[model samples]
Target: MDKQRDFVLRTIEERGVKFVRLWFTDVVGTLKSVAIAPAEVEGAFSEGIGFDGSAIEGLTRTYESDLLAHPDPTTFQILPWRGEIDPTARMFCDLTTPDGQPAVADPRNVLKRTLAKAADAGFTFYTHPEIEFYLLKSDKPGPHGLEPVDRAGYFDNVPGGTAHDFRRRSVRMLEDLGISVEYSHHEGGPGQNEIDLRYADGLTMADNIMTFRTVVKEVAIEEGVHATFMPKPLHGEPGSGMHTHMSLFEGDTNAFYEEGAQYQLSKTGRRFIAGLLRHANEIALVTNQFVNSYKRLWGGDEAPSYITWGHNNRSALVRVPLYKPGKSQSARIEHRGIDSAANPYLAYALMLAAGLKGIEEEYELPAEAEDNVWALSESERRALGYRRLPSSLFDAIRYMEESELVAETLGEQVFSYVLSNKRREYEQYRSQVTPFELKHSLDII
Candidate 1:
């Protein structure tokens, strides 16, 4: 702690950092910040900076509104978009209460607690996210729909295109902030882009994801366009997903890999996948929290509507990527249902917990999907023992409500806040008479 604190302080002094932004997130994953002068940073390291918790969504009630944000010095990074002149910096914060207890509602702490459990069980969780989003001319939607900055299809390298330049700039900025990018390219949907971050530990990866979103949006606004992580922004096009690759490690070795196992996946790996499949429906409220998230899940461009697992089966909710020769260290399971806009801290925590539960209980791995699961008849799918994920936000809530794992992972405060927030959102959504209703039933009725 002293070493990281010293390093952050020295860097700030040497780089002439004027403002140090302490960053955190709300229950719904909205990024929040409070900037402090560099002089007060050292003091904040021990005492933390206080704020009104009641004003922020899901933090605390009016009577107990005082909260503190203790900056994680290891997360210190100079804001690339802020420029070098009198430069500003930022660090992720872990929230606490007035009495110095870890805030149960703090999303970062939720992941941290789950990670501590993994460490105690002799494992480390790592994740790689292939994040997808769209570049739009503006946030507004016309009668036809929102406009994409470009119409290029997947992997089409149009030199001098806005999306190409946007991606290039984003990758550079991310690198500047010490993030490693594995790949970047155009995706299937018009103006949609995908960037995959190199795998890192669960906590670091969640922090990186928060940083990644801010960088992308900052770059987009500076370039005179809007960027959205909306899972289903377009009706007949591919939806954006944060399809995550996850693995468990024990010290220097990959726990998921075995030399002669099927698909080279160890029994531990199989059990983990089983856990994910069993809990996938319940965790949908965290992984795909929004109502629109279901649109992406069921909209059929390989969005995964059923709970099953297979080697290289895109339709299956959990997929084991084909083993590459001499790449056993890279062996991992890909979860396809998580939307890009999810709260990474909470999402990763629940995912790790589910998989760990499977290991603890020795869950039986199910039959692999031999063909496109989506193409199977409904009864055929049912007979094959395939179960569908929740089709709506309310349905997801129902599943989540019954999960003891989710409640335990999120703690009482956070679990209650999330349920309340989603309930309010659904109520407001249900009361609205939409364009579809007006067009279909208004004059006819």
Candidate 2:
């Protein structure tokens, strides 16, 4: 704690940072901030800044609206996208009640609480996300179509590619803000991109995800383009997903590793994967929260519709990358359904909780699906006892509403708020008319 405070102060002095933004996320994972002068950093750190929480979505009731945002000094970093004049820095924050108790509805706090449970179990959860998004011409909402900045496919290095330049600048900006990028390349769609982050502890990864989106948008604005994390931004194309690799560890040893085991997957790791497959349908709403999310999930382009696992199979919702000989630490599971638009805090919390529950219950692992599960007919899948995930936003919400594991993982406040908010969104969306409806019905009728 002392080291972080000193580093925070030293960074401000060295970087000529005049304003420091204390950032936090609401329940739905929108980044919110309050700027403070350099001289006020100490006081702000000691006594958190107060804000009316009721104004923020899914924060607090009007009567108990006053909430405090306490900055986590460890997250301090300079805003590289900002200009030299009055340069700014930012740090993620934790929201709390005036009495110093953690605010139940705060997404970050919810993750922290779930992490505490893992800590009690003597394990640390690590995550690395392969986040895919798009580089569009600008934010202009077109008439039922998206304008791509460049026509590029997976790993296509178009020289002088405007989208590539934008990605390079975005990567540099993220590094300047203390985020380590693993790789950045064009995705399997026109004007699509993927930027993967190095693995880190779940809480830090959540913080990094919030920062990553902001940096991407900031760099896009600076480069006179627009970047979007919307799942299925275009029709008849591969949709973007945040394929996350996760593992659990005990000190220096990988808890999920076992020697001489089939596929070198330990019993613990298999159970964890079982837990994920068992609960994935119930928690799908949290990971893919938007209406467009189902568009990606059900698009039949690599998205897994059924609950299944396999070795290095992209069609399964959970996959175990082939274990490297003598490399136990590298053993991990990848969840492919989560989109980049998810609330990382809630998503990671539920994931860890489900895995831990598996460990605790010693859940039996299922057989692997070698063939492409997507190619199999419904009867074949049914014969294999495979179950499909929720098909739409409303269906996901219906499953989420009854999930005891999800509720316990997110705590009551967040679970309730998320369900209510998503239901309302689905309601509003159902009431709205769309171009597709007009085109299909108006002329025909």
The numbered model that scores best in TM-score is: 1
Number of the top-ranking candidate, with lDDT as the measure: 1
lDDT of each: 0.95, 0.90
RMSD of each: 0.9, 1.2
Which stretch of 10 consecutive residues in model 2 shows the poorest summed lDDT?
137-146
**Where is model 2 more than 4 Å wrong at Cα?**
141-144
Provide the lDDT at 220 for model 2.
82
Q: Give the TM-score of candidate 1.
A: 0.99
Tens-place lDDT per residue, model 2, 147-171, is: 8888889999999998778878888
Give per-candidate clash totals: 0, 0
| Stretches of model 1 off by over 4 angstroms after superposition | none
Per-candidate TM equals 0.99, 0.98
